[model samples]
Target chain A: MTFVTITFFLFLAVAFLCYFVMPKQHRWLVLLAFSIAFYLFAGWEKFLFVLASALIAYLVGRKGTKSSLVFGIVSIVLLLFYAKAGNSILAAFQMKESIIVPLGISYYSFSIIGYMLDVYYKKIECEKNFFAFLLYMIYFPQILEGPIPRYKKLAPQLMEGHEFSYERFCFGAQRALWGYFKKLVIADRIALYTGEVFSNYKDYSGIYFFVAVLLSSLQLYTDFSGCMDIALGVSQCFGITLDENFRRPFFSKNAAEFWRRWHITLGTWFKDYVYMHLAIHPKLLKLSKLAKDKVGKRFGKSLITIIPLAVVWLLTGLWHGTGADYILWGCYWGIIIILSTVFAKEWKQVNQFLKIDGNSKGFSRFQMIRTFFVFSGARLLTAPGDLKVSAYMFRHMFSLWSFREFFTKGALVGILSVWDVVIVIIGTLILWKVDLLQEQGVEIRKKIGQYPIPLRWVFYYGLFFATLVFGIYGPGYQASDFVYIQF
Target chain B: MEEEILELLSAEFPEVDFTASDELVDDGLLDSLTITGIIATLSMEYDIEIPYEEIIEENFNSIAGLASMVERLQEN
Candidate 1:
């Protein structure tokens, strides 16, 4: 029942229809039923983990004590830990593996932890209704891959019944249409090329490996953000506005700015919960002061940024996965961001020394390109799914241009046919142009709305049929799951 | 007190306009980084420890808010 399937759409149609027909106060009941149905379709075992987390939060929220807050958070983190690595630990103990990693445990675990912290800090009144808490915790749209809702904002909206709005429904359907186009047409097409190149890294070199690295980055972007579009769009049809997760990330000019725009919800979650908490802790503050008196003021100030950022990045890496490559990936970004920030004055000085206009459009384009390659470097680390294969790809990446080989060989990557390559390129360009328009603050859907009904329907049906016909779904091209769902 | 603190902060972060808005944090004038910088700066200058609970937007929204927090911390 992934977003890329007809079954999910049928389920979605039923949910959306029932939602509008139910009595105003009873609409949430329909949502709850469908939400449970969606989870049950996935597996009943996964819901037990969600249920336990919800029950812990509900009990701690009702108790409303600091100790319960500690208890709740620790209990939730351990539950998440077991789901992440319990089997491995059990294997080491000569024990049978018996933990079931629930779907979207990473997403909900963070939500519940953040909710508990907010309640203890008196940021929001504790949620009294266990059912409402459960609904927010396991809301179907965001439960799988999340924008990671804040409790105060999403809980009330979940409980409140929304009247049907024609404009909203149109906007949502159009958004989902775009999502399907990206997921089916663009991402899966590129996946056909990248999957083969990455899996058989030994056979490719030079231009092939280089192109694979670049496409893998875009493959992830479209796949994950495509899913976000589906989730947010589906939620919006019911008058719920989930927080956005991507903001034209590839256009960012540096690693720091890139993170600010990419996977934005996850970054904000860490900033609020981990970075801010550590930065303002009295002990770290005291340590910084002592360093100032003992060593130097600049060194002391650097500590404030370095320590928290390192911890956040490490935890961010761990949250992504408990892998050696992911940890190094964390350190990779961490080091770049820390160095750039701590030496921001020096970076500006170097740009000045090189006679580069830091703010000019051309220089900004250069910076965007640099950020892209820097991002591709991080992708190179993780995309291979193994450290040694990544090293082999890196070492043999620059042997020769081999344009003749790439063209004269069996299409691209020995698997992608000519039409597949054409579709990927054309689809990629359309994605780029649309993202560029949105970057410039153009409301594309609104522009389409302003067109006469006949033309608008033409564009809509054109996209719909385009996805149906061109989407990669035949033999050997499976509809890949949204990339972020595994996280 | 607000005047003195504003003068000091302006000297430290000359690029910022402390008087631009009463809702600096709410209005996006102060970000998380700038807020952390302000904490480090005030902690060093006034020799006061700002606790975790005091790291809210209300305290860092404007120089006036910051001055009050600093005064309260300095007294304690």
Candidate 2:
């Protein structure tokens, strides 16, 4: 069920009631049953696929053997590959693929794989209790788009019996409502304008395409982070704390920092499972040492760091989708970050020679704006269906760089007006400001709560009204699925 | 004994000043990933496999705790 839908609210209400009323020890059972029922409601046919996968993982994990662990890992990987690429494989065989990728299969498969790997490596003990394992894998809130809870982070919480707390509930509900505002009101509305321009990019000129790129970036952030807020908020209602996903990504002065802030869980997952492992490989270490001895520490560190980053980005590109544009987008960011690091010393030298203050507030602000534009331009490649169209879009973007044509013109006027742009800017600023505060270890809500109740209530009511009036809801415009769900 | 482990810790994390009585896990001195790295290193250096159950914070509370565990494993 869509998090924004009435059916989801109903399910949550029922689950909440049952969860609180149930015996303390059996609270997990209540959640497990509700989760299963929720998944079944969403996609009953696919329930069997999820169930079979979960069971296979559980059995393999419980019955420990080196070979069993290897087999389990292989089986999970194969299932994911088939789920992801089954149609292409079927076409090659001259058969129409009957396999429907279960809703949330991409997400839960990672959870299952991570769990099995942890167990295999003996990093974490296997959960012999089938229900506990199921709950960890299928918790409804995160089943869709995950913070991708590790086994250790989630399993103990499921085992702990939580007494209902009014404070926790209030906090969760407020956060959920805030998420709704972001997703339905801000993100979906912005999407309308971005979708219009991007879908017809061939007809737009310089500034128009530029605006579209900016709007698309904002829309994606709001939609994905909004979904994350709701998922995390819902999990909070049950006192199951999921990891924070997005920080103030836009505030990042560099692409590397941007990755650290955006989709944080996924970045860390790649770091732990992929990057760090490869970074510390004996071959790479030897190469790094050799470079350090030959070329000096400065050049060696840059080479070592940039090489691994390139590989990580390549994998990251392929992981997003089986498309060339995505690959280019990933490589593009990778190159940007590498260049930034490679030129760090030179950049400092140049800044010093030019007598420019790198620490000046105005200069920093300009750099941030420049970085945003550059990132947006790179992401424009992601909008098109293929590399050819993407290349055409890029060519047109540069070729038709007339300020008058963009401001005066055809496709731009039809897509976004001044008011829409204003709203998007305001919304993005608010999100960035909030994330910045949180990153600095400020307790935003707590500080807000210190205000007079009447003021707090006013703020709350204003948020609610804004959402209700502006939220993109009606027939024929389905809530777009969370982008990370496909991963 | 704890001082020895602290020396190792100091070598790995130059910024950290390890104390024998410090609550390493609770103070966030060691994150889960770091813990995994430590376990892997301990196994290789000391030729001891730490069972999953032994990974609890009680056995890794301080340098002394880890050293004691390592000593026990060596004896075994």
Worst 10 residues of 2 chain A by lDDT: A407-416
TM-score of 2: 0.83
For model 1, the stretches where C-alpha displacement exceeds 4 angstroms are: A90-98, A410-413, A474-477, B74-76
Q: Tell how far residue A367 is off in model 2, in angstroms.
A: 4.1
TM-score of each: 0.97, 0.83
Model 1, A82-111: lDDT tens digits are 877777688879898577888888998999
Question: Which pairs clash in model 2?
Answer: none
DockQ of 2: 0.11
TM-score, candidate number 1: 0.97
> How far is each candidate from the true structure, as Cα RMSD in Å?
1.7, 4.6
lDDT per residue (tens digit) for residues A105-172 in model 2: 76787778778867876788999898888889998998888877799898899878788888788688
